[model samples]
Every structure is written in C-alpha cells, then in structure tokens.
Target: MLTRTFLHFPQVGERRERALWRFGFCDWHAIVRSVAPSPWRHLWDEWQREAEASLEAYEVGNAAYFAMRLPKSAWWRAIPDFVHRAVFLDVETDGTHRITVLGIADSEGYRAFVRGQDNFDEARERLESAKMLVTYGGSHFDLPVLRANFPDWQLPPLHLDLCPLLRRLGLRGGLKAVERQVGLSRSPQTDGLNGWDAVHLWWRYVDGGDERALQTLLCYNREDVMPLPTLLALAYERLWAQTLKASQQTFLPMMGSKERRTG
Candidate 1:
C-alpha cells in the first residue's frame, strides 16, 4: 500500500490569484485587461493593484511587509526571534534535475510530500504562511525548484539563507556536515541514503512503481527534515550569545573611563 500525503485546498478567493501573480504565472497587466469583462474582474484588479503597490515599495529598497523589514535597532534581535518560527526547507530532485519531492519542518513537526500529493499542497500553504524561511543552500537550488514546480504558488516566505549565517558563526560545510559539527545525531534508519540518493530513489518509485524504493525515498526525506530544528537552535545560540558578548565588550571601555572620572 502506498502512503499518500494529504493537503487541504484553501477556500477560493482573491489571494489565490495574488499567489499566482506573485510567482509570475501571469502578468498583472495582461490578467487585468483579460479579466475586465467578468463580474469577478474587480477581484483581479484589486490583486494587481496591491501587487503593483508592493513592487513600488520594494523598488525604493523597502520591504515593509516582508519579515526582513525591522527597525535598525531591532534587526539583530529579530533574526533569532523570527527563526524560532521558521520552516527549514529542502528538496529532492530526479537525475534530470526535476524536483520530485519537498521537505519542510518547524516546531509543529516535519512533513515530506511527493509532487502531486495533497500533503505537498499543505506544505506549500504552510510555507506561504510563514513569516520567515530557514534553509541551507536553498537560495540557489531548493527555491528555484519550488518556484518552477508551483509556478502559481506564492513563494514560501521571507527566506533566511542559513548557509551564510552558519558560515558567519564559524560552522563549516553542508547540512550534514554542519549537523556533525554541532553534534546533532541522526537515526539509524537514515544511514545509507544521502540527499542525491533520495532523489534517485523517488525517481525509481515514480517510474518503476517499486514500493520498497518509495519507502526508502520517504525515509530519506523524513531524515532531511529531522535535523533542521537542531541546526536552527545551534545557529540561534551562536548568533545571540556572540552578539551579546560583543555588545558588552564594546560598552566595557566606556564604563571603565566613567568609573575613573567619578573616582
């Protein structure tokens, strides 16, 4: 028996069109002109208007609605706080470079879904809902696959490339390497399969319909989501503790001089 993932369809509304537009499924100008005759045309017009406003805001180097927009004084503090709710994302693709599945995890739990599953849709929806997204090496690879696969789906969320952040904190290497460096252990079930193998396994399952292959693929995907929280926690510890210590050291010199003057 195949284990299928489930997804719920959000109620049909204006946001769906906005999602489509955001991901570039259709041009706002073209859509607005084409839909002008329909009664629901107003909905499309409103969506396009809002999209234009959003683009205008971004053009001026402001991302006010995005999670990265924080007051300068609060920006550093916000990174750690926001990461707590972030969904760490990863993807597996076929040898031909087509994405076969996606994995995401947060405080709630981890989820992995094949391309056509309702669970895939649910995962996409959750991604759309997040205030921040955390991923290692997702900026160039994982994200492009997602946008390509779900052209009508809005982007997952405001992305935080944990790869750079991890580097900044002196942790070196890929996701698995970082896991090992930070002392996060993996379960025995995930022993043999790495991400590339996981993608091939999915292709085997999809093309050959081998149940054992599918099981292996799912297990690998589950493993991918499992370590993300630990990695995120480690990042938080390193950034927050280091930043706080630096702040104190910066202030310490002023304190000594003030004490000498008072004495």
Candidate 2:
C-alpha cells in the first residue's frame, strides 16, 4: 500500500494520485519507469531519489520518515509494512482528564500501566519502541492525555487513528459501536462497560482499595486494545478494494525487486 501511494509527491493531491493510478503508474516502480514526455518529467530523478531514501528508511524501521511525509489519514498504508513493530494503545482517564491506566498491546500481549501501581516510564519506553501506534480515538483523546502526562516522552512514529478513518468508511460512532457493526464482540465481563465505567472503577480501586475494580478496569482496557488489529486488517482490505475500484485496476502487478525490498 505504501508503494502504491503517490500523495507524498510534491503537488500531488487525491485527484492527481487517482489519475496517476488510472494512467497505470500504480506504484513507486511504475512512476520511476515512466518515460512519456510530460511536465513532471523534470522531477522524475528527484522522485526516484526520494523513493530510494524512503525505501532505506523502511528497511531500517524508521517509520517517522514515512509518517512525516504521508498524511495521517494515509498512515494505514504503512501499517502492514511496519506491523512487526506496531502496537495498539488505549488510555483510561479520570473526570479531570488525568490518565489512570495506560494500556498497550503488541503481537505478544497486553500490558497495563496504572498511574499509582505501575511505573509510567515503562509505558513511555514501550511507546517509544513501537514503529506504529494503532488507536481508535487516540488522536483527539488518548494521545492528548498521554502528551500531557508524559510531556517529554516521544510517541510512536506512525499513529493510525481509526476514529476518522472508520468514519471516512461510513462507519461512524465510538469504538464499541464500530466493533459491533464489524462483527467484533467483547467478553461478558468487559462488554457494555464504557469510559465512565473505567473512571469509576479506577476511583473505586484508588479510594476504597477494591482490587476487583482495578482488575475489571484492566480487563476493559485489554478488550479495547485487543480488537484493534482485526479492525485495522479489515480496514486495509476494504480501503484497498475501494482504491482498486476507483483506479479501475483489475489486479495488482508484481513490484520490482527494489520496491519489494522495502516491505
């Protein structure tokens, strides 16, 4: 998907990108090999250099390079490519918007960092190590709270916020709502619980020393993170199909060795 992206090129918008795809310049290699005389021909050499640099950055696991170049909405294009180091994150906050639990899940499993019980430094460390971050509404909510709490900490290089992305796909509403729409379900223990419930659970644990409350909160957070990968996988397929339809592409071609090396 990253190779199929042309929006990173200068003066290229959605219209131009679709036009390029329709013109059979469907990937980086296609664009690099374009030989027909055109106004953009002068920039071909520069584009090739940039593409090579991007490929190098990808090979080195430098997700920030693509994050800086591509629009946030396009970050999904880089997800499958960087999924080896991708992590899903979600945060539980109190009424004051102070974070109580910071949960992160990778391919291994889920881990929760409670404000009082666990060291947030570990959360920061985990986040920093991730090449990509997948979150539902993290861009507007979870991430802002994290930035406020960890002022000096660096977030994952690529953040794929599914909130707007799913919205763009006509799947509006919150995480659980979208989940149900897409046939994802939660366990009975964590099902139906929402953010307010998380906040109350945290207070119950903090004020009344109710260990069960903390455990439940952690379970809720776990549920939140676990379904993200499935959701992202679904989105990628749906969007790819949409892109192919829009570009009138019947099938994907074999990418050249240089282009294949990056992924």
What C-alpha lDDT, on a 0 to 100 scale, does residue 246 get in candidate 2? Answer: 79
Candidate with top lDDT is 2
What tens digits encode model 1's per-residue C-alpha lDDT throughout 1-263?
00000000122233453344333334323443454445445555555554454344434423234333332222223344345456778888885557776778876778777766645668877786665676787878788887777788766335766677788888888777877888776677676567777766877888888878877777777776677666666665566566436433222121112221100
Clash count, one per candidate: 3, 0
Q: What is the lDDT of residue 191 in candidate 2?
A: 91
State the lDDT at 79 in candidate 2: 59
TM, every model: 0.62, 0.90
lDDT (0 to 1) per candidate = 0.57, 0.80
Clashes of 2: 0
